[model samples]
Target: MRKFLCTCLLFLLLSVPLDAQELDIFGYFEPQFNLIYLDDNYYQLQSNKLRVDLKSNLGENLEFGANFDWIVYHGKREWNYWNFIPERVTSRYSSARMWRYRFTFDDRSFLDNAYLRFSFPSFDLMVGKQQISLGTGYAWNPTDIFNVKDLSDPTYEQPGHNAIRVDWPLRAGFSLLALYSPESDWESSGKLLRLKGRWQHFDFSITGTETEWGVTDYEYPFVNLFTSHKRRLLGGDFAGELLGLGVWGETAYNFVGDFEDFWELLIGGDYTFDSELYLMLEFYHHSLAKSDYRDYGLNDWLRFFYQEQKSLTRDQVYCLIQYPLTDLLKIGGSTLLSLSDGSIALVPTVLYSFHENIEFTLIGNINIGKEGKAYGSSQGHSLLLRSLVYF
Candidate 1:
């Protein structure tokens, strides 16, 4: 999924002069193209996404807001590939699928977020499909359980979840959060609570959640793709500055009914030098992962892909850097390594802002390592070209 938005929205609303009580509308459209090279084969992927967002002040204390997405996607192959599918792809209230023509697979319309809010001096109440994203990590998040992220490109747009949340502010830097999200058929509903605050220069949050998982039957496979299991998650995150450097971390422990407890931890820091160059490094460990790929057979892989486990492999680190070359152009890259098997993936990217309403991006990914290792086994290179327009 993606996490892009909020960049030019404010400008869009203010740039167009409007009456005091007039509703404000803004959105963007992006056409993305990808050429995938893997295992001596090549494939093309393309999709166009459009989102329309609108909001109106119901009164001083109440607001109504909604956004809908219309996406048309077609690729050389079906997106049924495990890695391409999201962990929580379906919801109880989402019934917008239509017109099944299997030339490939795609959906016409998606209801991303539609919510209403009533704000007070201390608290606010929100209901409907919305984003309840939480975390402090950049590349990987061990504590953002509400919406699992694809850290491959953290700046892109992603889908939101259907949930209800209440936020309360206590002191200057202290607040409280509570959220509830239900599964499509009540199979994986859950509740979350977090107490967040800041002391001195450090911002911190402690979170707890109880949820159920919908497990598929190994015996019947696709016939019984749904079952039940309970789990609990306890975690926290902190981000602050350390001696002129940016420091952050996140940790989470899982208690699954059928398996032993497992946990992951990420620690990292970022330092910028010469005013134009920024760099960051992070290291993480997974308690449940093994070194050998054979040990992580089909069932084990499914668990991790579905986020029953937090990571695809264990013992990893990341390095990311960015530099702006000019007023409208920038270059960036990132590298990820699997310390367990010494596999690594490298990504190089170029970004150009043609205008305030248009942009272009080019990126390439290269994987290197021995066979059977995490990034090594998936060794190949691919390029992506994306165009974005705001209207």
Candidate 2:
């Protein structure tokens, strides 16, 4: 059904006799391989992905854009016997549930972005599925509710949200933005309002959001289930240049029904040298995080895995250093350190552009910690190789 719809859309676009400047098409293809080693065992996986993007000018003040992605995967699909356990705790008494993991190589296709925009003299309106990314933090975006960040690949593109969005420019450097995402009921729907502006050399935004967030909550002795809860969020972010470094911070306070209220904060700064070396450091804090490793429980793990919680530990630090070895090659390394438990995750990356239209990346993840910590040695380390070709 999806493939047929995509084919028909392509045929319709091709059948149209519009000016070349009226329509634009672009996309990329990626092939990837992954290997993981843990507890003296190794697992391998492979995937191929294709993305197609389309943009067109329907008429004056009207435009349309869409992105389609199709991906296929193969290899090992399940792993049992690994779990998060704190020090001095046995598996039977562990607070966190044992892992139930799988990597399935199924063919998946989706429309990541499909939206229509109407521009007026005073405001702009957008409708349909579209990317709604917010916040200034790179590794962690505490103020963004529509998406979750993968710690290992923080900058990857995220899925879109179905919403109606409006942007109203208030002044030369200020604007008001609103978004509404309908759900089955009014209470469950997502709504947001933001005021953004620039002052001197800094840009800032204040936002308010209300919605029902789906999450995994514990249901008694060893049982965990998915559920939804209402939450109201008030947040703000600011980015500016301080001295020669780029600095940014994002903070959010959540009021959740039937859950503890807490705060999330992230601060980071980056600098690039004349020699092309770049360096960044960031700090993240979660008020709801467990201060002691032993205080971590099954509920914590469940919520973290389900995207309700940002971190199981109270504090973390991230550092990134990257340099271009040549015009075609770049190397970088990043470290995520858990200040609450002294665990660390090291990620080293290499990128090479073999051709103007083709690029390859090699990434490695190594965890160092005692058993039961966030980045524990038992959590399994992995390496990934991926190639991207652009049309």
Candidate 3:
């Protein structure tokens, strides 16, 4: 399928007349190295990623765009050490998934974006695989269902999804968005609706999403059960400035069939001083999480690591601080604390710019806690170095 798509894109590029339209080609190359220490074991991994983006205007009201990514991995592979566990695992469509496959697998290539868009006076229509980003939170986005942020690198580009999207501009600084992502049948498809506008001094959005979700239950070491249910999510987010500081809030209420309903909330703010020091803090709460770590079991740990669940604890806090040591170099660090279990993760980072389009980054992560707790001492730490060159 990837080969066929690449051929079609090549054909389009060749058939389109240069005089009629302008084609833009650009992208980047990045290589990253990782050294991890976990459970008294040291592991090394390296990955190189290359991406090429293509964009063109087909006509006055039509446009086409696509991006292709090829990545190669070396060192460690195959880390699923739970063969004794049940085969019943939840699908990663509706919730977050660890994305650890990138580091634990061989080389791969895929298309991240391939879409055609049409513009009109009243609304705009987009079809095929495209990028869908929603919500106002930085590290956590409760109102966003299409993609989940990686807490370690929250601003990285996300994989695209195949869907049909519509954007309609409304009167009085408001707009409406609708999206449909098909599955094997309409009854199990994913759908979303959002109404966004500015009120007073803040920008706000109300969003609703409906989809099917699957989860696996275990009965000790011998029995396992799998169940599917319809899940509905309703949420809203707001971002604005207050008293010389930037503030944002996001919340979501989830209703899962036959399962207990829950609410997730996040509140955050950031400020900068005259000395070029930056500070940011955010607090998150999960109503469905277990309040005691002693109640957690093996199944719960698997679910949390696989990203089928959000967190192992009920409450958490994230704080970040940054300062510029020189014009070409900057230093920063962040701390993630699980308020429920007294576990914490500290990450320090340094960034240097070699040239206008070349840069390097170094990051170190240290986890601290009891042996069996979340972000526990047994998890150890890791260091990562990444270099990027843009074209």
Q: In candidate 3, how many Å is residue 283 off?
A: 0.8
**Candidate 3, residues 165-264: lDDT per residue as tens digits?**
9999999999999999877788788899999999888999999999876666643333446677888999999999999899999999999888778788
Residue 57 of model 2 has an lDDT of 75
Candidate 1 lDDT over residue span 1-391, tens digit each: 0111233333334554455446779888988898988657888988888989978775676665778898787686473333322223212112232111113546578768766676988899876668767778887777776665555676565567767789999888899999887664444687889999998999999988878755543224333255666778899999999999999999989787885677889999999898689899999888877666545444445555555555667888888899999989999998888888687888888889999999998888887765545665454568889888988
Against the true structure, whose lDDT is highest?
Answer: 2
TM-score for each model: 0.84, 0.90, 0.88
TM-score of 1: 0.84
On lDDT, the stronger of 1 and 3 is 3
Model 2: how far is 58 from its true place, Å?
Answer: 1.0
lDDT of each: 0.72, 0.83, 0.79
Could you tell me which residue pairs clash in candidate 3?
A: none
The best-first sequence of candidates by TM-score reads 2, 3, 1
Of models 1 and 2, which has the larger lDDT? 2
Native-structure RMSD, model 3: 5.3
lDDT of 3 at 169: 97
lDDT of 2 by residue, 37-125 (tens): 87778888888999999999766777778999999887865544334333344444543544332223568998898877889999999
